[model samples]
Target: MNTTSHTVAVLGAGTMGSGIACVMARAGHRTLLFDVDETNLGRGLDTVRGFFDNGVRKGKIDAAQADSAVANLSGTTDLGDLAPADVVVEAIFEDLDLKKETFGRLDGIVSERTLFHTNTSTLSVTGIASGSRLPGRVVGTHYCNPAPLMKLVEVADGRHTEGWAHDATLEFLDTLGKTSVVTKDRPGFIVNRFLIPWENSCIDALESGVGTKESIDAAVRGALGHPMGPFRLLDIVGMDIHKQVAMRLYEQLREPRFFPPPMVERMVAAGDLGRKTGRGFYEYDDNRLFGS
Candidate 1:
């Protein structure tokens, strides 16, 4: 594992962005969480700090370690501020053009050897890499939600990705205590291909009166050995996001299993999106967005 500290920049200040920044900081990297919106940037910084502070609260880490990790993280609005970053991980909106444009702009700001990682759950890595002059450095790094807690990360090399960049990305991820799973640069990669359909089926079970969400969740945890049940996971993922991802996959692969059930549409339309909205398959006391 690499012991040398590196400067890392995470674009976008959403749930995924904050989580990734937290991981980098905890690994002793100088992490800059960037966003164009000042309010989002501030919120993201707070979220990153919260992860460390909460770790100390739960005794997952010592106070000094939490404090040190927080100290290593910063927030920025200026893109040029990331010039010194050795690796840039983007967790922005799921817009192909915007993703491409960000990479294109970043290519000129950062070093030629800097790795460009896109945490895109949908969309093509090859398509995103097209925007970069250094396409060889662009790789798809789809981090699981709650990036700090999730051990698995799906890595996909674009058509033009260089072996050096791919190897370096794996090394960097290892330093952050992540397990990298190499996959083809296809839509949904590996996790979503299985996750979306399974989630939809779980929702189906609830709709068909098979069992209450709680009972079903419990059964899955006991039988399938999953950390959390589908409903609970969907609540964390947000109903709207799940619906969007499901619909997109269905449209692309024409798979019936990828289709979101009617309950998803109803919940989304009613603004019961998830933890961010304080409700989904379940309710939360607070409206704060969870990791991813």
Candidate 2:
């Protein structure tokens, strides 16, 4: 893995944002995690620290390595603090207008050469790029959930995205030891296009009494060669997020398979929002945002 340090800023202090920041810092980059809310920012920072500390406890990284990664991470409430960033990754809310407005506002802050990467899962890259004056520099980088653990990153170029920006984005992901898969700027990119429907099917199977949640998860892990079953993955992703992403794709594609199963509504309503809420398909001792 490349250890050369670079200045990277991740917008939004949510689980995804903090996870990506942890990945960047672990790769020796100076990562600035930004959020408008001070409380959220603090919590996000704590999440990142928890990830590094867990690595030490698990023996995945030594104490010195963990300390170095933690030292490379910082939190900021001010967007102006991101001025020195070589790359600014926008992982804020999934709202298109909010994503657009963010890149537009960053135009005045960062250098023209800085890459603007939008982590929009359902929105069009072209639509988000329309907000920025430097549309050529705008690229779509959809990181799988739990960014620190996921090795694959989907790289999609907007209609106006320049070849230089696309190349640079791929290179940046490489530095972080991430596998970059070039994908179309379409909704869900590569992973979600298949994952959402498959997850829905799994839910349907469980709901229809074809198998219990444990049996279904075990079947997937044992036969399909997945690290975790649909239920376990959903637990990490949060049931609310699955519903939102699934519904967004369904609404856009007009596909019945993209619709989340009815059980999703019940789980979300019950506040069983996966690990973040201490329960989803299973229970957790603590409400950590991601798995160790």
Candidate 3:
């Protein structure tokens, strides 16, 4: 399908998924945002509106343009409605089996030429693609958190991904005003490959009692010029999610350093999931609170 002829359907209306849908809609694409839960679907639509409103208030986007962008977005709770999409992006949970199953269903619904991409952070794109009927059409389009704001888009060409499917995916990302990096089907691709190791190192320091949370955060910010320290960043990203990704990476690579640290596991077990849960490495009373 030509770019204009295709609609971008994003499955899951959470932070990342909603951000992606907003990006597409802002780019003037007819974007569909789908979620099974009513509350999530409503929140996702509200997120899109809030994003454009912020842009307009900041003079980044005119009110007319922002309204049009929102008009381009439609939310739904049904996956079957996504059959009309020329490109479907699965941006739901990080569970591999669930993602594989979703892709399999999407493969059956979408046309043979319709491209499929997953916003998976660490799962193997090849594994998901292999599980689908149209493996050749399945690729990875990993976006960072706050997809509407983040410019980096990693495009993964799985073992079977090639030709028009691959090219079209890259084009789609470019049209969304993102900088696209085409990566081979490899563990963690580019960003996570290096960033994950750094997170692991931070965990080691914490375990070794290198310093208190405050000291470590201050040191990283002051000495290394990092905007936020590793632990503080983990709080925002959610410790549970971070640990899950680390464990999966460690499992796939069998590298000891990639192992999820004990403290992270402890926190997850205690239900200190992070900002979403109001407690994590640090405590929050709403305003995205952080700690040392």
Provide the clashing-pair count of each candidate structure.
Answer: 0, 0, 2
Q: Where does candidate 2 stray beyond 4 Å?
A: 1-3
* TM-score attained by model 1: 0.95
| Model 2: per-residue Cα lDDT over 102-218, one tens digit each | 899999999999999998889999999999999999999999988998899999999999999998898899899999999999989999999999999999999999999999999
Candidate closest to the true structure, highest TM-score: 2
Return the lDDT, model 1, position 27: 93
Candidate order by decreasing TM-score: 2, 1, 3
Residue-by-residue lDDT tens digits, candidate 1, 227-252: 88888888877787888888888888
After best superposition, candidate 1 residue 167: deviation in angstroms?
A: 0.8
Better of 1 and 2 by TM-score: 2
Best-matching candidate per lDDT = 2
The regions of model 3 sitting more than 4 angstroms off are 1-5, 58-60, 203-232, 282-292
Lowest summed lDDT window (length 10), candidate 1: 283-292
Per-model TM against the reference: 0.95, 0.96, 0.85
